[model samples]
Target: MANNQTLIPVAEPVIGDKELAYVTECLKTGWISSLGKYVTTFENRFADYCNTQYGVATFNGTVALHLLAAALNLGPGDEIIMPSLTFVATANAIQYTGATPVFVDSEYGSWNIDPAVVEAAITPRTKAIIAVHLYGHPADMDPLREIAQAHNLLLLEDAAEAHGACYKGQRVGGLSDAAIFSFYGNKIMTTGEGGIIITNDQALSERAFFLENQGRYSDNPYWHPEVAFNYRMTNIQAAVGVAQLERIADLITIRQRNAAYYNQRLAEIDGLTLPPNQDWAENVYWMYSVLLDDTLPLNRDELRQKLRAANIDTRPFFYPVHQLPMYDTKQSLPVAEDLSRRGINLPSGATLTIAQVDYVCDELIKILT
Candidate 1:
């Protein structure tokens, strides 16, 4: 490893001039708060991009989930099924409503929730199934959708990392009863920090909007019918979002291209398993993830330390939510644990260049050899 090498970030947002212009307009007009044209524009455009009929913008992804939970009347007695191998917010959202989040294992093929396991995990109390498009790969939704319909359970997507990803021919965010997306600094798109819930159900959309705005009805602004949180996305955030949405295709394309290059270089490496893109899915490759095979002499953490020493940044896969201290249930989901232990997210930001990818791979090969 050389001492003069530049560090590459694991993920980064792509911002442009349109974002600044939109925000500046918001400022000149004194519409800095959530009330502004950009808000609705971003909501509608993003919803339309995802092939959804409506979108309810939120301060962040977690609140979007909470709002959805609240809108659905999910409470203490109910349960929602989701893959254990996901960001904590997925489970936290359901937990916020006093509803239980039942954890399931992931399948090897796509590194997403196993539809078979999901079906097995369902119980009478289960009200919904959330299929997160983990690391940009869509979960096998058709089977999950079938299971949901047969049992009369709602299906949802946590597509925080999977902007523009698609299943079969249809885009995400509209595949199920509803879906949520994050526009944090690290997501494929950036709004600085924001989120949205997209769905075709007009009732759910209206209810979510009502809940996010403190449950206030327009006719009675001062009279709040029910207690709800103020979870509105700022005009500034939406300004950035609308700008990013305009370049959404480029954002997705560059990442996919980078992933292809990574796959080309890393595929022959015996101990590395490249990210998956199923035939039925169009992966956005939100993060070019690879798993460390047991055949590798060094473990995942050991390799990460080596890459860090070489001035190339990386991130380990998230700890399955169920294994976290608060959510610990002594359940043994072998697949998720194994993947978490071995998976690594390389510098997958949109701005990364080919030379940077070459440098990272060179260092990795040296370390592995």
Candidate 2:
């Protein structure tokens, strides 16, 4: 066994020689700022990879969401429906546009926003639905698309955790009207801190570009037409992102292999529920999250404590957004509430070795048994 003091983290970005070379070139060329060829190159390449027509690079994922909201012209009295079992950024992005975020429960099977509940949550004030691909599994998009079309509601995808995931043979980023991706240090891919908005609509793409770059109708200096944001991604970040994108397939394979190793070893254990992979979905396993059944001898937090003592880092799932103090609502979402209390994310970085995965599963089995 590795030393007990050698902590295995829940996630880590894989930075290699190509990333170093790219960033070093950026530094040597003094193109480290927001304006450079690397930024445009990375945007085009990433958008193409996701089968989108255009990409608008941003300072970070949250800002990308905010940019999308701005492009859609969401404002006061408007509503955007989203799952409560998600990172706070999803809700926060909607609120940024002066729109109210309506919380919906997650489905237990996929841990994504429930389409049935989504329809029920919509009111006359609803203008959009943010379908978050939680934990790298694509949400049931076909039904959501149908609902969006029927109601004339815009369907936007929060694909931050689902870089290479697919549903019904289409990539997550292309399944909706538009999508946003995060390149945070711990994501499947990394740019230190950057994000991009992808869309097939040309007008929406142009609008996002205009909004992110201070609302300049043209690149000409000192000509602002409307209120906008300074949410541009730095060239240094894009350099890293380009290198990361080059190896995205390999990185995803490594994560999936590690997850498989854990699944095989941990399957026999009782009181543990493995992450779900629906028949129509290709899960990228952003983090190999599992739920501890309520009947387990130890609860999720208790298990996390045991793992921590053994130098194994684990993370609890997000607290349902509706329950958070800032957006506190009396709405009771049973599935999201139950899953939040029991779910835990294991060590699932792309660079994690089979032996390391075995160690984590062994430690978890020991704690549960």
Candidate 3:
């Protein structure tokens, strides 16, 4: 165990002076509600940053996806295909629409939804495919796009973990028909608790905006065309978002540098598989994850315990959605199941220092060795 008592966190929001100033201004101006210039500014700036035509901010990422489902008119018999390895919110969003979520396995190469498995899973009931950019790496989008195009299905991206990640020289959010981003505190850019839907389709953008604000159109006051949700992001959250967006490039750089340092130090260690660095993709390393080789003496949980004892915090990867009690099934998914058991997220916070990374890595190596 380290002599130093300073606890290294697994993930944290990097709130700087700009965030404080913007939030303070929002409070001083009494624009802390959903109706404020900060919300509009944040939507526009974030949309522009992602190379999208429009952005509709929402209360959170899950609600942003739920709004997308509502806009798409998904319900009852409609089915949405997604990887079983991602956060439950992805599947839950589809479920909220009264739609069934079809589980697909992830690719071992990138640890994202396997496009090859997607085609076989699609049926007449399939409405769309939610390709998640898992662990900051973009999924193999070209083939997924081709599949969507061939089947006349909408291709959506879950870019919750990939703020600045890119695939084949294009941004992940712009590559799909529409994409959702989570601005949760631990994400690369934070809005305290918020999300945004980015799309090139004006109709979808307008519908999302309308549905997010209690189904009442701005032009038509007190007229409810249909049941909707109050999923609007508050001005305070947007204020923080604008500031975080301003520093996103720098934040991404810091994460990349930290990941590189970890790679250098941990690559030589046996019984560990580092996160992938694809030639066609630039991963943002949202959480620097590794899969413990089966040969390792310690299991993933055991290793985490050892790391914690050394004052180095870590997190386990998400369990397969299909395996969860809420969506229990007999269907077998070998890759996702294997990854869930073996993968562990090291401390990859953007604010983490090089020395801190070294300490975490040294302790990790010591435990593994």
lDDT by residue for model 3 over 1-369, one digit each (tens)?
Answer: 333377688889999899999999999999999989999999999999988989999989999999999998999999999999999999999999899999999999999999989999999999999999998999999999999999999999999999989999888899988999999999999998899999999999998988888889678879998888899999999999999999999999999999999999998889899998899999999999999998989899999998888887889999999999999877899999999999999999987989898888888778888
**Pairs that clash in candidate 2:** none
lDDT per residue for candidate 2 within 1-369, as digits (tens), equals 454668999898899999999999999999989999999999999999999999999989999999999999998999999999999999998898899999999998799999988899889999999999999988999899999999999999999999999998888999889999999999999999999999999999999999998888665857987889999999999999999999999999999998888889999899889998999999999989999998889888888899999999999999999999999998999999999999999999997888888888788878887
Model 1 per-residue lDDT tens digits across residues 1-369: 232256788988877789889899999999999999989999999999998899999999999999988999999989999999999999999998999999999999999999988878888899999999999999999999999999999999999989999899889888999999999999999898899999999999999999999899888887888999899999999999999999999999989988999889887688898899889999998889999999998999999998898888999999999999989978999999999999999999898887888888888788876
Q: What is the C-alpha lDDT of each candidate?
A: 0.91, 0.93, 0.92
Q: What is the TM-score of each candidate against the true structure?
A: 0.98, 0.99, 0.98
Superposed model 1: Cα runs more than 4 Å off: 1-4
- Over 4 Å off in model 3, which ranges? 1-3
Can you list the residue pairs that collide in candidate 1?
A: none
Model 3 reaches what TM-score against the true structure? 0.98
Error of 1 at 221 (Å): 0.5
